[model samples]
Target: MLKDIVDVLADPVDGTPLRCADDLSRLVSESGHSYDVARQGYVTLAGGRGLNHEGDSAEMVTARELFLSQGHFAPFVEAVTERVAEVIDKSHAPEPVVLEVGAGTGYYLSHTLDSIDGSRGVGMDISVPAAKLLAKAHPRVGAVVADAWEGLPLLDASVDALTVIFAPRNPAEFARVLRDDAEAVILLADQGHLDELREPLGILGVKSGKLERMMRQAEGYLELVGDAELLEFPIRLDRASIAAQVGMSPSARHVEAGVLRERLARLPEFMDVTARAQLVRMRKS
Candidate 1:
């Protein structure tokens, strides 16, 4: 699977091309830097100082897998896939490359890949735990662990379509990596996305002006393609699903496990939760 998107990869240190070496046990860059591939079939492409952040813990990745596998975010995934399909058709790339930054569990990337023919994906995340699942999530995907804030381990103008779902974004880096006419489809959870659970679970709330702030951050590098679309849906989740949802989010880090359990126990067995997010399409300026 690494071979599928190897051409899109670059040395994290010097931005040179990389290729499989020592029978695919490691990746060697054109600049002579070496990065070992893990036995789990994923590669860590960090610089000399190594990764600055551990994207997600194993427990969080597990929770995400459990929650997403049950199709709680089906609408979000479908909307992403549909937008990507449209972008690919307009780009007309024969073998388009789709890169998902902070791609947890590779769920979104794999789903988008399945919807498009002759498409390859780079599931890039900073988490080793997430990369392990991303490696086997799809046959056409290559999983890589690299910090987004530092700089993506990818070649300039190499990616055709990029997706960031409730993940970090380096707008300048994104603009550099995306080819002309290519688009980056981003999804951000809007305020009141989980109003029902916020009060009950004692979780943090999404603040307003998120989009304006994001656009300001992207100024001069990436431009909004069209009006941001609001996707709102209601999902019926049982207590376990609700737990998984909370466990996989930033709320997990803030709330104590025992306290969260106690709060979850007081809620109804089945409750309807609203999932609301804004999807924005952007391209290089």
Candidate 2:
């Protein structure tokens, strides 16, 4: 699987090209760096300091898999795939390289790959637990464990399109890795999202001005392509689904296990919850 998008990967230390070596068990960089490919089929590309962020834990990844597998976020996935397809068509790349930062479980990435023929993807996440699933998420996907905040381990102008689904982003790094005609699709949770669960589960709500803050952060590196689209849908979630949703999010860390369980038990067996987010498209400035 790593072979699929090996051309887009680079040495995290020097930003040089990397090739498969040692019977495809490791990636060797042009500057003489070697990174072992995990037996699960993913590789870790960190600089000398290595990864400072542990990202999501095993339990959180498992909870995410459980929640997503139930198709609770189908609309979000579909919207991302549609936007990516539009970008690829505009670029007219015969064989495109798509990248997903903080790609958890490769759910959204795998969906996008399925929609585009002859396309490959590199799913990058700092979490090893998430990378393991990402490696086998799709036949054409190459999974990598890398920190986005430090810098993306990708060659300049190597990516055709990128996607970030409720994940961390580095606009500067994104601009460096994207071609002149490339674009990045981002989905962020908007205010009022999961409002019903916040009060009961004691989870934090989506803050206001999230998009404004992000636009400010991308000021010099990238610019918005067009108006952002708001997608709002309602889902009927049962108690189990509610718990999985909370467990997969950052709120899981703040709420204790006992208290979260108690709050979940008090909720009705099935309740309607709103799913809201803003889908933004941007390109290099």
Cα misplacement distance, residue 34 of candidate 2 (Å): 0.5
| Model 1 poorest ten-residue lDDT run | 46-55
Quality of model 2 by C-alpha lDDT: 0.95
Q: Candidate 2, residues 1-285: lDDT per residue as tens digits?
A: 999889989999999999999888999999999999999999999999999989999999999999999998999999999999999999999999999999999999999999999989999999999999999999999999999999999999999999999999899999999999999999999999999898878899999999999999999999999999999999999888888898899999888989888988999999999999999999999
User: Model 1, 1-285: lDDT tens per residue?
Assistant: 898899999999999999999998999999899999999999999998998889899999999999999999999999999999999999999999999999999999999999999999999999999999999999999999999999999999999999999999999999999999899999999998988999999999889988999999999999999899999999999999999999999998888989999999999999998999999999999
Candidate 1 segments whose C-alpha is farther than 4 A from its true place: none
Give the TM-score (vs. native) of candidate 2.
0.99
TM-score of 1: 0.99
- Tell me which residue pairs clash in candidate 1: none
Model 2 worst lDDT run, 10 consecutive residues: 252-261
Regions of candidate 2 where Cα sits further than 4 Å from its true position: none
- Give me the overall lDDT of model 1: 0.95
